[model samples]
Target: MTAITVSRAAQIRFSPGQWLTAGLIVAFLGLFLIVPTGTVIYTAFVERGTGTLTLVNFADFFRSELFVRSFWNSVYVSAMSVVWGTVFALPLAVLTTRFDFRGAMVVQTLGFIPLIMPPFVGAVAMQLLFGRNGTVNLLLNDMFGFRIPFMDGLNGVIFVQSLHYFPFILINLSASLRNIDQSMEEAAQNLGSSGFRLMRRIVLPLAMPGYLAGASLVFVKVFDDLATPLLLNVKDMLAPQAYLRITSIGIADPMGYVISVILIVVSITAMWLSAVAMRNKDYSTVQRGGGGMARRKLTTGQSIVAYGIVGLILLLVLSPHIGLFLLSIATVWSFSPLPDGFTFAHYGRVLEDSSVYIKNTLIYASLAGLIDVIIGSAIAYLVLRTKLVGRQWLDWAATAALAVPGVVLGIGYLRTFYGVTLPDGTPLATLWFMVVLALAIRRLPYALRSCYAALQQISPSLEEAAENLGATKVRTVRRIVLPLMIGGILAGFVTSFATAAVELSATLMLIQSNADAPIAYGLYVFMQSAAGRGPGAALGIIAVILVALCTFASHYVLERSRRLVEQSHGTRH
Candidate 1:
């Protein structure tokens, strides 16, 4: 917060190395984030054909019937998505946190599984199960001679998004519930509140901060999603329209920039709304000598009901993974309760035809993750350790990426880097290297948070001691601070890599050659063809495994880090 003045020791602690590092960070942020964002804002107000600054782009966008419809559709779908996200998350958070129940661990794990897979990856499989001519529809037709509009048009976007993103709500709510004081519950129960009524009136209201945080996050994510809407053949949404305008028409489309501006505005508004909602509320119910929320043991009837509810939710949540597996091996699955046949031929076919996508994903995502760490570590050090001017601005700028939709970023690159050609006369946007850069830009926020957190745990006295012992500032960081924070840095890298591997919206636009596409783009390509889904499912399975392995590895590293921290404290004691 407060700027540090240059004292004798402070001047000695700062070095040429920190100066150079801070300069590089500013340059990197400006080049990647500030430039593209500035370009978008500038171009949105400027007409391309006349090269004149005017508001006609906004006026024309307002006049277009399709654009108006798309604007409302995004608003309507994102609102519905947040509502469903709560529905899916609240009960599960309640059951797992407030009661002792069977399959509690399994339920939590299942709730998370949906999030590991991108909704677009499962859209095709969901179609096979809930599409008009798919298995579920066929079964319903035979049983009751009617079908539900579960996957119809924009409804499909809401359905897939609710399932995929509800984990945000569950995770945040679970934490809030855990930190709640037992005295509040006791007081409420003493006043004739019990069971669901107790939770609804007291517990839920108190957890509003976490609930609103997760809900706003879901709204922002759903509003910015491009792949899910495209997968469902619903292109009227703002994100898809932006992509279509940029790539399908031309890079000079001002309307695309206008859409990007709107997306950014909407995302920022959602986050602001969350903050505003929680601003004046006093949620502190903790006591100086507080106890805990006693977990109630379920009665036989309660146990059965809880298990039934959890099982049904798990089935619904896990349908994407199950559907993907079944579809991957199915020979012919149309209009049938089961596939006519099963085989590994799809996996074989994909491996034989195009395994390069998988390899490219690994290469691009890994490198992007590495780049994230480099910048994350630097920014963390500057913000936390050094007295660099406006260091907080670096952190703020990176976090701002969360609100910048991938599709918007993609279009921005096209606009900013237009006509920039490579050595081979190929455009810069088409290069695999640019995709890696974009991925790093998009994921740096995650890694930066992790690194900043890790550095916060280490005391500055340690670094000062190292400096007093004649260690240079660079050596102090390399030898003292980094060793302590390596575990968190590793976890951050894995998270960035896993997320980047599944990224589609940005990758789809940057990829000019089919040969250079990543696994997510491959998944999209496969789903486009009736015969290609089998192979797509096989690819989807591999992507899921990659992410799961990374998640487990991150957990392991973090656990090991905690142990190391405990051991260090023990030594100090």
Candidate 2:
């Protein structure tokens, strides 16, 4: 008999498996994307009295000048903030990555401190530091006999947001800068190119992709942010306008939906344009193995100036959080460099009544984190590994959540689930399912990005070898692929947990009264009361500690896994 060897393709039929995967994907999309979006559209149209469709809501939104002003204001604020953020962050990234300097590690860590604070908390800290009666103003009045206009209008909002988000640009650009090959710069320098000229020609172009990505993210984040504007009293912003329409006015108002739709369109368009910019450029500057560290000793004056610049940036980024932390421990923080009185009363209050917020935040964050990692890993695998049709679109769709603001998504949920009834006639007004789904969807982009990046680093040959050895696709994926991806998945999980814990805008809208409230919401409420500030500060402190713990855990796990992988590689070598 002729030696008959069945092809691996014959062993694994692409037909059934592909169809099943596709079906599962379709079901997932329908449950998460289609149903929630459909709810928004359905509620926007359905008339209350007649139970018929109407366009009055949209019409009112268009006709309202206040709404129009808010839309324009949001655009202006986002544009201004992005410009300032880039200006501040790009140089910082260049200094940290290109020039050898003291305190670089401290500067980098300081830059990222703002990322841990809740949006409203940042705004509140800004208010405390710069408001008319704030510490700066009080000092100025004491010494200069006049008050400065610092915390009001569009300017304050832009300043706070830029301070908060510039790190995004810094981190992205620094990674890109570190990845640039020294050979190119060495060649340029040998060709009689001056330092400035070399940077302009050789470095900037390579870093443009990362710069653009950071800029795009900042724009989207600032554009959709509600807390800063609201706290700063910038009434003319898109997010607060949407909130006013949904909560202050009513969901029946079309103005909110209109603003939401506009915000979505703008954010999506920005993301698409950024993606295009990234696609056209070879961002492989940061790829593995080719580019190594290029550390150059700086002259005395240059080193001093670099250290000074880093210190200034660190101060700008960290002062607000420092102020907040102090305020959290104080009986009253007004006008003094030190608190009026130091007390642990705030911490005690938080500890005593912490059950509800703590439980809710942990439960929701844990659930969302777990679900996001599982679903996001599958999506990443499907998009990166398989040659499925529309995989590109699926990848895009999965990440599309990044463009949707928390406020807009919350409103979309409100609109979609307004009248959704349970099996009984009672209307399902409080849809925790939809809330959890929204959190998962909003966080999916990060999880997917982390997973996809990790997946890309892994060799596909391992999977192919397993299959050739008669391992089923599912078995191979479970035994081989997942083990390699544990680090990435854990990273995603921690990120999701951190974000879900601090998430404010969506939780504000979706959380039902008499139900559990997350720490962010509780902090907001506590901040408003006389005794509330103490508890609020306490909650904020707890949140910071929790986030720090999770981040450390993630780093530890990832590092251990990486060491194991490296040892295995060494043994094989």
Candidate 3:
């Protein structure tokens, strides 16, 4: 009897669905994470002649000044970006969320523009404006008889990255600030608390979670970025270091793997800290009753300052795409204030050769979007809705991808799947499936978070009611849960699609020699070739338009679907 009871208890603990979910999670980690990581480690350590593990890779990396300098350089750049991002983002968030001025809506929208633009595009744009022959440089030289040195190395990379990522901090902090109960601030103000003291004691502590979350994201992103550094010739960083080990040096060099491991460790630590910060606080300001938006009137001077700030931000964010658009349409690009002449030749050439790039990007992005929504929804359900063992670990693992740099993951994929062959004896060395998989995995964290946020808003009693009526778990999920969660799934899909479209570093390593490249990669190639900058600019312009169209379409579809659901529910009632 005792033995039977123990056996039953164990069986209950490891139920079928739980086991199945666990298996799937493990399989995903194995294929995408473990196998690739293990491969890198294995290749890094294995002795060529004796086929025995060694530690030469670590030794070599530690001894190399280039590697050490790049590692510290990466840390310095990322830290600086975070500091600047926070300094600018905090005030903007507080002002926009706490006190409203004229054109507040416009300010909020403009602040988020950088979120959609690719980091590489931002880097390129900065180069065009601040480079030796750039507009700013030309102006400075004409006025002061000297040019500014802002486009060569660390300074350029940090500036562009910070500009591109500050929006993340702004949006996050804004949301956090908006979530603070008005009564808390009201009570403080009533007690004669004013100015910085009120913010220091009440507002900052309340909004710390959002600030930390945003900072963590920026740190991980800047750390993992490869394009900004690469474009600016700052290859002493981990991203470029890892890339060089694979392409410039041979895969036989273990230094890349060592950097990969270190990146993973640092990213995981950042993520862990962010998770700890977010655990006790709720950052959801879009709830049912959040006071219907806090509205505070701004003074005349404040309104002018707010509008000026918005205009400046818009100019900064839009300048790159504007320059790219002009270059794309110009017949000749010289050191003039504008293009030499406008023509449709570049667009025509792009259209003629657009099929391959367009098809590849659509296919890969679509597949990644679908896969992310499904996997993300399931993980969200498992963690937020179900009572599962080791749920927190699963949640953390799902999001851990956010902290990983695309370049590092790309290297891991190369190492893990390099020599392995598929079932029909076809070598997997040139398969672009790994590239798609990497994109999917890399973008999974955001998708999962979006879905989790949506799922948490739903009442558990709804699912319980369905189950009480004898509905099977699967049926209830399909009929009851999915309908409610479709909005989240679609949102995740849009976000994932956008990220995959612009992803560069991971694609750089995983893309096959013969396979079609996405627009970002294609632009990189075109810009580097002998054909000057016309073609690359044209392609960038097209890519930007496509992204805008897709996002607008997604918004329309989601809004229409939501309205239809509401109408149908009203009819039923």
Model 3 — TM-score against the truth? 0.90
Superposition error at 479 for model 2 (Å): 1.4
Q: Please list all clashing residue pairs in model 1, or write none if there are none.
A: none
Q: Estimate each model's TM-score.
A: 0.95, 0.91, 0.90
At residue 531, give the lDDT of candidate 2.
Answer: 63
Question: What C-alpha lDDT values do all the predictions have?
Answer: 0.87, 0.78, 0.77
Model 3, position 121, has a per-residue lDDT of 67
Which candidate leads the pack in lDDT?
1
CA lDDT, candidate 2, residue 174? 82
Full candidate order by TM-score, most accurate first: 1, 2, 3
Which 10-residue span in candidate 2 carries the lowest summed lDDT?
Answer: 1-10
Alpha carbon lDDT at 350, candidate 3:
78
Q: What is the C-alpha lDDT profile of model 2 across 485-510, one tens digit per residue?
A: 99999999999988888888888888
- How many steric overlaps are in each model, in order? 0, 2, 1
Model 2: lDDT to the true structure = 0.78
